[model samples]
Target: MKKILVCGMSQNLGGVECFLMNYYRNINRNKVQFDFLCNSESCAFEEEIKHLGGKVYHVCARSKNIYQFYKDVNEFFSNHAKDYDGIWVNKCMLNNIEFIKYAKRYNIPKRIIHAHNSNNMENTIKGKLQGLLHYIHRRSIHKYATDFWACSRDAGSWAFPKEIMKGENFRIIHNAIDSEKFRYNVDTRELYRKRLGLTNSFVVGHVGRFQYQKNHEFLIDIFKSIYHKNSNAVLLLIGVGELEDKIKEKVHSLSLDNAVKFLGVRNDVAQLMQAMDVFVFPSLFEGLGIALIEAQVAGLPSFTSTNVVPQEAKITNLLHYINLNESAIAWADTIVDSQAIHRELYVQASMDYNIKSAASKLELHFSNICNK
Candidate 1:
């Protein structure tokens, strides 16, 4: 079996991690095995990776100690370079190229740089400086890496220049999911609603980490408006992060404590999705919204911010993209006016963003690379 080193694994249960897990679960592990190299010492998926016959290695974080990070990476590649045939690095920002530079030095045949985000959420001076450095490093990406990949066209265009994106080495890999698991079911909706004591309420759902990029503050504002208009309306939030407490405080200040529920980092996302009447995602920006795709698979009408999410995410007519400048009351009005139409949308999701098809295409790509 040919081994590949995969980078960017973390303890956080966010979009990038979810996309990686979906791909890992569907890929043909017998022929091509993946070993993760993460900056943190521990991650949530480590145990499951071990169970699946993969290994996880820890290195120093780049932000904490750049010199130590490089030392650890160099030592690792020096000792175990021969064990892997390739390196696939998934990065949220395109600012760091040291990983790919080291991989090239180790003579890895297939060095792949996969971009997962279109823009960084940070807007500080330090962030601007880092962006400048990213621009400098991106100029030399083709010199160190053999392959380029992204989750969407916007992501690819942001990571690489237009010329490189138009080159033959670039590939757009969709953020696919298991549509069968997310299919809408009335029985599941009833069961989850009863379990959560939401039998008589109209639930507005949002699934994402509590971060600035997700615009949870705006979502809360919109939910507050909805609650004032309809006392029976409930807002269900799933996932956790550093900003959870701050958001909770905001909810308390707005006196929306009883109307909002936060269920952090859930394993039963599909079931929870079934219980929702509408999915609201008012993100500041996104490379590709995976949760929105999952919501469509669950047959829920979704409202997202325009220019943030790509149009390719709309596999069904259930998705609606609105401008961020719109008032919270406008968002609330749209949410209330929209009616949930129950249907098995998994068939369309399967055709547009299926894990099986993605895995097969990836396997073929790897095979072709090996043949050459």
Candidate 2:
């Protein structure tokens, strides 16, 4: 069996974690096994990883102490340098190169750096310094990494220089999912709606972390507009983040306590997707917006901001990209005007964003490298 060390696993419930879980669940583990190297000792996926016959190794968080972080990296590579056939590192920003450097030092033949975000979401002074460090180290990334991967074209262009991106070493890997699991199910939708006491309500749903990038404040404003238009409308907000409390307070301040439902960090997101009449995502930016694709698979009409998401995210006609500068009322009007159209799931997405095909491609890539 070929063992590949995967890095950047975390406890966070986000798009990247969802993508990893999908890939891990679908991959042919008998031929290519995966072990994780994470900053946290425990993660939401750790139990599943162990159940799948993989091990998890912890390292010190780099942001807390840089010196100790490098020390841990060095020690990890020193002890397990030759144990793995390759190293796959998933990063949101292009700013961290310590693990790739260590992998290069240990002569790891296949060092893959996968980019998962189109822009750096951090804005503080420390964040700027880290961005600077990333810029300085980026010049040598091509030298150290054997392969470059990204979730979308925009993300690829964001992380790597144009010249490197044009090379054969670069690959655009879709943020794939099990589309069949999310296919439209009228029975399931009715069941969940009744369970949540939303049988008579027109539900507008948004699934993402309550971070600045998600533009939750704007989402609330849009919901308020929709509520004014139709009193039977209800907003369903999913996922939790640092801004959850603030967003909840905003909901309360708007006197929308009864109309807006906060369903934080749900495991049954696929089932919940059924309950929504329309899905709204007004992110400031994104790598590819995996949730949008999932919503499309679930046959929900989706509205996304054009400022951040690339055109490639539109798999079906149900998805509409609108400008963020539009008024909240305008956004609400558009959502209200568009009739919800049920779509067949897994057909188009299977051609591009299905986890089985994606995992097979990765398995083949690893097999080719092992043979070489």
* lDDT at residue 200 of model 1 (Cα atoms): 93
lDDT (tens digit, per residue) of candidate 2 on 266-327: 99999999999999999988989999999988888899998689887888888898899999
List TM-score per model, in order.
Answer: 0.96, 0.96
Candidate 2 to truth, TM: 0.96
Question: Residues 1-372, candidate 1, lDDT per residue (tens digit)?
Answer: 668888878878778888888888889999888899888768668888999989999888888898999889899888877788888899878687777888889888888899887887566687788788777877878899888999899888778888889889899888999988998888999999999989999899999988778999999999999888889999999999878999999999999898899999898999999999899999988889899999998889899999889887888888999899999999999888886365454545754489989887887777676556
- Per-model tally of clashing residue pairs: 0, 0
Clashing pairs in model 2, backbone N/Cα/C closer than 3 A: none
- RMSD in angstroms, candidate 1? 1.6
